[model samples]
Target: MFVETEEFAKRLEAMDGLEREAAYEAVVRWFAENSGRITHHMHLAPAHTATTVRLGGGEPIVTDGPFVEGKEVVSGYAEVEVADLDEALKMARSWPACPIVEIRPVA
Candidate 1:
C-alpha cells in the first residue's frame, strides 16, 4: 500500500526551510520504528516529476502533478505486505507525525 501525508504538499510548500526539515525528520523517525517490517523505503526528492509510463509497450500518459497535491508531497514511502488493510492502517496510525496514509493494493 502507498501511505502518504494528506495535505502534505500544500503544507510543505508553505513551510520555511527549517520547518520542512523538521517535518521530514519526524517522518523519517516514524519509518525508522517500522523499518523492520517494511520491504523497502524510498525518499522522493522534490526534483522528481510525475509520469505514467508502463514498463513494457502498455501506454504513455502525462499528468499535471503527482497523483495527489497536498501540504506535503510523498517525501518518502514504505512498501509493506500485511495480512489485511486494517493491519496496514494500524501501522500507519503509529506514525508519530500527522500523516495521511494512502493504502493501495499491489497491482
Candidate 2:
C-alpha cells in the first residue's frame, strides 16, 4: 500500500507506547484475517533506500533515491485474489495503517 510519509510520521508521533503497540497488533490481526485472500505481500524499505533505474537512449541511468518525489510512496504491497474490485476496495478500506492504500489490478 502507498503511505503518505508525513501522515505516517504524524500518526506515530501522536501515539503513546501502548497505543503504538496496539496499532501494530491491529495491523498484524488484519493480515491474519485476510491471509486466505492474500497470495503474497511484502513491506519495502524506506524510500531513501530505493534505487531507481531509467533506461533510454544508449545507456541506462541509475539513481540513488526513489524514482519520484511525492507526498505518498509505495511502502508495501499485497497480492490479493478477491472476487471483484469491490472486495479489494473493502479490504483496502480496512487497512490498519498507512493513510493511503492503492488497489491496482495485476496483469
Candidate 3:
C-alpha cells in the first residue's frame, strides 16, 4: 500500500510518547489480526533512500531519489492473497496509519 509519507511524519510528530507507543501497538495488532491473509509484507525505507532506474529509453538512466516527485510516497507494502478485489478493499479500508492505501493486483 502507498502511504502519504508527509502525513505520516506529521502525525508522528504531533503525537506524544504514549500516543506514539499506542499507535505502534495498533499497527502491530492490525498485522497480527490479518496475518492469515497477508502472505508477505514489508515496510520500506524513507523516500530519500530510494533509487529509480529508467529503462524505457535505449540506455538506462539511474536516479538517486523516489520514482516521482509528490507529497505521497510508498512507505510500505503488503501482499495479501484475497479472494477478490472486494476483500482487498476491505483490508485497505482498515489501515490505521497513513492516509492513503492503493490496492493493486500483483501482475
Candidate 4:
C-alpha cells in the first residue's frame, strides 16, 4: 500500500499492463499455494487516513492519525502457523515483499 521513494513511482509507471497483471498473479499464486498454512488474512485500507485510538485511564482518546509518522506503517496483517520459528522464517522469506514482511508470534 506504500512505497518510500520517488524513484519507485517512476519504476512502477514503466511496468506495462501485462507485467502488472503477472506480478499480481504471481502473488495470488503464492497465496493459493500456501492457503492451507495460512490461518487468518486481512486487507486494510490505505494508512494515510488511519485514526489512532487509545485510552489513558479515562475516556477514549482518539487521534487524527497513525501512532507514528513515517512512510512505513503496519498496513495489514496475516497470521500463519508453521511447524516452528524456522519454518515461519522460511515462509516469510518466500514472500515477494521480502524484507518488508515481519513475522511476530502472538503471545
Candidate 5:
C-alpha cells in the first residue's frame, strides 16, 4: 500500500450536476481513447476496510480503516498492462490525480 494526497478528487466532487455530467462524459471518452493501456478500471467501495486474521489462534484484528498502515490508502486500482516497467511507470505518472500508484504483479 502507498499514500499520497491529490486534490483532483475533491475538485471533481465539488462540481455541480451539469458539470459532473460533462466530466463523466469526458472520462468515458478518455477511457475509450486509452482502452489499450487502461485495460480494466473500477472504483473501490468507499466503506471498504481491512480485517486481519491471526495465525496464533488469537483474536483477529480489525480496523475501521485500511489494513495497511502507510501514508496512502488505495482508493481504487487499475489492471494496466504496458510494454515494460519503464512504460508502466510512465503511465502511472501520467494519471490525472493519482497521488500514489502501487504497481504489483499479479501471481
Candidate 6:
C-alpha cells in the first residue's frame, strides 16, 4: 500500500487546511474500513541523487545525478500486510488520491 509520488509527499507535508483535513478524513475512513487486513502502513522518502558509484584504487568517485527522471517520482511507500498481492491491489484501487500504487513484499 505504498503511495509513491512527489506531489503526494508535498501534500502530506503541508496538510493543514480544511480541504486537507477533509481529504485526510476520507483517506482515514478508507483505511479504517479495511483495517481488518492491514497490519501497517509506512512511508518512504526517495533520494534525489544518483546512486551510481565508482570504486578505484586511487580514490572513490561519485556521480551527481539520478538513475532516471520522470514526471512522477517515487516520494514514499506504504506497507500493508495482506493475504496477497491481489488484496493489496484491491486496497490500492480504493485509494481516492494518487492512483499509482507500488505493491512489493517486505523482506
- Give candidate 4's error at residue 36 in angstroms: 1.5
List per-prediction Cα lDDT, in the order shown: 0.66, 0.88, 0.89, 0.69, 0.63, 0.68
Give per-residue CA lDDT, model 4, range 1-107, as digits (tens).
21223344345578899977886687678788889998877766655688988888699888887777765566567788788989877776676532366777788
Model 5 has an lDDT value of 0.63
Q: Which tens-of-lDDT digit does each residue in 28-66 have in candidate 3?
A: 998999999999899998899999999978999999999
Order by lDDT, highest first: 3, 2, 4, 6, 1, 5
Regions of model 1 farther than 4 Å from truth? 1-7, 45-48, 53-76, 96-99, 105-107
Tens digits of per-residue lDDT for model 2, 1-107? 55657778677899999999999899899999999999999988888899999997568898898888776788889999999999999999899888888888998
Model 5 TM-score is: 0.62
- Displacement of the residue 13 alpha carbon in candidate 2, Å: 4.4
Prediction-by-prediction clash tally: 13, 1, 0, 0, 2, 2
Question: Which residue runs does candidate 6 get wrong by more than 4 Å?
Answer: 1-16, 44-68
> What are the per-residue Cα lDDT tens digits for candidate 5 across 50-85?
554444558665456656565455677777777788
Give candidate 3's TM-score. Answer: 0.89
- Tens-place lDDT per residue, model 1, 1-107, is 33345465566688999998998788678777777778987766552465534344566555556655654455556788688988888887877554556777778
If candidate 3 were superposed on the true structure by all CA atoms, what would the RMSD be? 1.4
Better of 1 and 4 by TM-score: 4
lDDT of 4: 0.69
Score candidate 1 by lDDT: 0.66
Which has the better TM-score: candidate 1, or candidate 2?
Answer: 2
The candidate 4 region of ten consecutive residues with least summed lDDT is 1-10
Better of 4 and 5 by lDDT: 4
